[model samples]
Target: MTLRSTLTTLAAATLLALLPHTAQAAEPYPDPRPITGQEIIHDPTVSRLKSGGYVAYSTGGIIGARLSEDGRHWTDAGNAFAEPPAWWYEYNDKADPWAPDLSRRDGRYWLYYSVSSWGSNHSAIGVATSRTGLPGTWTDHGKVFTSETTDTWNAIDPAIIRADGKLWMSFGSYWTGIRMVELNPKTGKAIPGAQVHHLATRPDAPYAVEGPYILKHGRHYYLFASYDACCQGVNSTYKIKVGRSTSVTGPYIDSTGKPMLEGGGDLVLEGHGRYIGTGGESVFRDRGKDVLAYHYYDAEDSGTPKLGLNTLRWTKDGWPVVL
Candidate 1:
C-alpha cells in the first residue's frame, strides 16, 4: 500500500468514543493542535494518496490542498485543482467550484464538485481527473448529472462510495432531494441506465437540507448530511443529521424507524456556546466510529466561520451523538 493507505490505518486508531444523544447539545471538545498547511480551508475531505502522503481538499469556493505527514500535523497548503469544463461558467458567473470530493482509485485522483449557485435547482455535478492530484492538472469529464431548473432536486455535494465492486455517487438538495446513481469506473461517468432515488426531503425542515456524506459501520451504510442554513454568523441554524440503510441507494431510516426519504432526521450536532451554525459536514470514519469535519462560526473569536472537527459516537442504544 501507499503512505495514505498506511496513515488511514493510523487515523483509524484515533477514533472517538460514542456518547448519548441530546438536543441540549455538547460542552465543547478541548482544543487540539492545529493541523498545519490547512489554514483557511473549510469542508475538508481527508484521505491518503498513493504517494503515502495525506491529501485534504475543500470548498473555499475553490479547491484548496494540504499535505499531512502524521495524518495530524500537515505541511504547507499546496495547489488547488482547476475548474472543469468550458461552459460550466455559463450558469455560474462567479466561479463557485465548491465542495470537492477527492477519491484515489485505479492510480488516479478523481475530483468531483458542485458548479452552481446555492439553494437553486440550477446546479450540476462535474468530474475532472488528475494523474498526480496536483494543481491545474485535471482532465475534465464535463457534467455527470444535472438537476438545474426542474422538479428535480439540486445536484451538488458529490460523494463516491465503492461497494460490492461498483462505484456509486450520492448527491442532491433543494427541489431535488438527496439521490444516488451508479458510476462507470473507467470514465467516471454515470452508467447510462442508472436511476436516481429521492433519499430525503423536508419542506418544513426550517431550511434546506444539503451536503450528504456516507460511512459504513457493521452492516449498515450510514448517511450523514447537514441540515438548515450553513453560513450565517450568529443566527446560523445548521445541524448534522443521519440515517442508514443496508445499501447505498438508501431508503435510509433513523433511530425512530422513521425514513430519511420522508424527511425524518436524527439530530447529531447543533450550535451551542458562542459556536453557531455547526453543520456543512463531511464525516471521516477513521478507526471504528465516525469523526466529523465541517466549518462553524467560532464561539470565542470574531465568530468567523472556522474549521470544526469533532467525533460522532454511537450510544449503547445505537444512535449517533455528536460531541
Candidate 2:
C-alpha cells in the first residue's frame, strides 16, 4: 500500500478509538442462561438463602415467589405473604404488591415492595423481614416510604444499596423517573427529615423510565434502570440502561459523559431474538460472579413473561456487559 493510504487508514482507526463506546455498532444481546419449569415472573428480585438454594419474589399475586435448589431449575413456591396487609388497600383496591426487592442484612432478609394503582401517583413502598429468606416466612414491617397524588415523583420499584456504611433506598417511576432517600438502618425505613435525592430521569414528557438497581463495583457506583414502555408483552419496548458515578448519589454519567438526570445512560441489554422487551433487572452476586436476573417476554411462547438470568461481565473500561 502507498504511504499516503496507510497514513489515512491509521488516522481513521485512531479517530474511531477516541470516540465513545456507544458510537460503535452495539453487539447483539446474549441470551439468558437457560432454565426449566415455572419461569414466568416480572420485576424479579432474587437472593441466595442462608440455608441453601435461591428464592425470587416478583410483582404479582401477593408478591409471588419462586425457588431454585440449583439456580438452573426453578419451581413455583407460593407468595411471600399469605394475604396482603390491610394497609395496602389504601394505595389500590386490589391491595396488590409489585416489584419486591430481596436482600440479606444483619442475619435477616429484607424485602421491599411497592403498591399502587395504574396511572396514579399515589403509591407506597413497604418492607418485610424474614429469617430464612424463603416463601411464606416474611413478617410485615409496614410502609417504608410513600408518595401522594400531589407529589411530583411516584414511589414504586424499590431497590436498596449499602454504600459508604450508610443505607440508601432508590425508588420511583413514570412521573419523574428514579429517586433515592436515606434509610435508618436500625429501623430499616427512611430516616426522618432525610432529604429525597433525584437520581435519573429522561428530559421528555412522561419520562418513561423506572426500575432502578444500584451495584457498587470497584470505585464507581453503577446505576441500572429500565427504560421505555413495559408490560406490553410482545409490544413492550423495555430495555436496561446504565450509568456510573463515583458517589452513590447524583450526577450519574453514561459513556458519553451525559448526566443521567437528563436522559443519559449507556445501553446494557435490550430485546433480541426470541427474547422481547428484556427489562426490570436486578443484580446479585452468586458464588463470586455477578448474575443479572430480569424478566423477558418470550416471543415463541405467546409473549409470556419468563425469568431471565445472565452472567454480568465487565469490560476493560469497567462497564457491565451480559455474557
Candidate 3:
C-alpha cells in the first residue's frame, strides 16, 4: 500500500459516494390466487348468494354467468337471460347486455346491467329483480338510466352503492369517465330529474377510466376504477386504481390529495407475472371479509380472460391493499 495508491483509492471511494446511487428495482406485484374450472370470464361482478355459494355475472352472452359453491371452484351457469329484451336491440343490434351488477336488498336480489354497441355512447342501464339471484330467475324491470350520442357521458358499467342512506348508481365508460345519479331504492331505478354527478376522469382524450365501484369503509367512501386500455387480451393494459372521499358524491382525492375528477388515483392492482390487464372490479363480502372480484388475462393460458379474486385489506392509514 503506497501512499499514492491509498490516496487514489480514497479519491475513487469519495467519487463513488458523490455520484447518485442506483435505485433498487421495485418488488414485482403478487400473482392472483390460482383458480380452477370455468374461469373464463370478463368484467365479472360477483356476489355471495343468500342461499349459499357465489354467482358472478359478466359481459357476454346476454350477461354470462358463473357459479361457485366455495368461491374458488367455479362452473358455468349459463346466461342471466335466455334472450335479450326487445329494447336491448335499440342500442346493441345483437341484443347483447354487458356488465351485470347484482345486490340483495329487502329480501330480493336486484340486478343492473348495460346494453350498447361497440364504440358507441348510445347506451342504456336496465334493472331487474330475482327471488333467488339465480341466472334464469331475474325479471326484467326496464331501463333505469340512459345516455345518447349527444350526451357527454356514456351510460354503461352500472355499480350500485347505498351511501348516506340514499341509493346511488355510478356508471360510465370512455366518453366522459365516471358519472353517478341517484336511484329510487324501491324500484331500483334512477330517480327522475335527479342530478348527474361526475366522479372521476382523465385529463386527456379517450379518458381511459371506467368501471367505477364505490365502497364505504369506516367514514370514508373509496372509489375504485379501472384505468387504461382493455379487451386486447395479451396486449390489454387495464389496471385498477382507487381514491377516497368523505362524501359519497365527491371530489374524491387520491393518496396525494389529487381529485379523482382530475385523474388522480392510487394504484391498487395491476398486471404482473402471468396475469395481464387486470381490471373490471367489484367488491363483495363473504364470511366477514371483503373480497375483490376482477378478471385478468392469463399469459400462460394464451391471454384468455379469467376470474381473479383477492382479499382486500386496509392499511392503518386507510388505503386498500389487494392480497
Candidate 4:
C-alpha cells in the first residue's frame, strides 16, 4: 500500500480509539431529580403504560399512587381503592397496604400488594387489576397468598415476572428469606399444584433481608433484595443488594461466589449524603434502559420517604451495578 494511504488509515484508527464507545445496555445511573407533589412513597415500583405515561404504586393508605409523564416529575394519581378490601382488615388493623408490585400482562395491569401490621408475619398478598393502569380503576382480587403467624416465612413484598411462558412470583421477608411460586397466567393466582421454591436469605441472627424483585436480563436471573433495618427515616440502615443465577428458581450467588442462602449479596446502592436507607427496589425496563426505581429516606426533608430512580447497568463482567 502507498505510504500516504497507510498513514491515513492509522490516523482514522487513532481517532476512533479516542472516542468513548456507547454501552450495549444500561446508562450511567443518574442522580434522581427532586420529584414534587406527594413525593412520600415507600416501596415504590414504576410501570410505563402503553400511552407513554408512567405510574408508580407504593405502600400507604389506599395504596399510594403517583403518575409521571417522563419518569421524573411526578404528581399524585390518587389511591388504588377508595376503601381497603374487606379481607385486608383481617390482617392489618387499619387496612393499609404495602410494597406493591405493578406489571402489565395480557394487555392489562396487575398489581400485587401486601397487607399486614408492623413486625407481624401474618401477611397477605393480593392482586388488583386495571385496564388503564391508574388508581380507582383497579378491581380487587382479594388474597392471592397468605402467611400465618405459625408459618416460618413472612409472605410480604411480592414481585411478579413472566418467565418460560408462565407467571412466577417471589415473595417473602425476614423469617426464612425469599421464596417463589408459580402463578396461573390466566388467573394471576398461584398454580395450585406448583410448590413454593426457596430462593435466598440471611441465616444469621436478625436475618435482615426482604423485598425480593427478580428480573431476567440476558442469560441470568437477577434477584434484588433489601438488607438491614428500614422505616427509620434518616436513621434507617436499608440498602439494596443483589445475587444472580442462571435458572429463575435459583441458588443465587453474589460477585464473591457466595450463595445468597448463606447471607451473600453484591451491594447495588446504599446511603450517600442526603439519600439514606435506599431500598424496596423494583426494576422497570423503559424505552431501552433499565430503571431501578425504589424509595429512599430524604435526610434533609425531615427524613421523609421519597421516590428514587436510577439506571441499572450491567458490567461487561456480567454483574449489575447502579450508577
Instruction: Give the candidate number with the greatest lDDT.
Output: 2
Instruction: State the lDDT of candidate 1 residue by residue for 157-182, as single tens digits.
Output: 88888987899888866563577888
User: Which residue pairs clash in candidate 4?
Assistant: none
Candidate 1 achieves a global lDDT of 0.72
Which residue pairs of candidate 2 clash? none
By TM-score, highest first, what's the ranking?
Answer: 2, 3, 4, 1
For residues 169-269, could you state the per-residue lDDT of candidate 4 as single tens digits?
A: 99988888899999988889887768889888887867889999999889999999999989999999998888899999999998778999999987788
Cα error, residue 177 of model 2, in Å, equals 0.6
**TM-score of candidate 1 versus the correct structure, residues matched by position:** 0.82
| lDDT of model 2 at position 26 | 72
Q: Residue 265: error of model 3 in Å?
A: 0.1
**Compared with the true structure, what per-residue lDDT tens digits does model 3 show for residues 1-323?**
99999999999887654432111014366677777799999999999998999999999898999999999899999999998889998998899888878888889998899999889999999998999999999899899999998999999999999987899999999987999999999899999999999999999999999999999999999999999999999999999999999999998998878999898998888899889999999999989888998999999999999999999877757878777
Q: lDDT of each structure? A: 0.72, 0.92, 0.90, 0.86
Q: What TM-score would every model get versus the actual structure?
A: 0.82, 0.93, 0.91, 0.89
Model 2 alpha-carbon drift over 4 Å, by segment = 1-25
Off by over 4 Å in 3: 1-25
Error of 4 at 223 (Å): 0.1
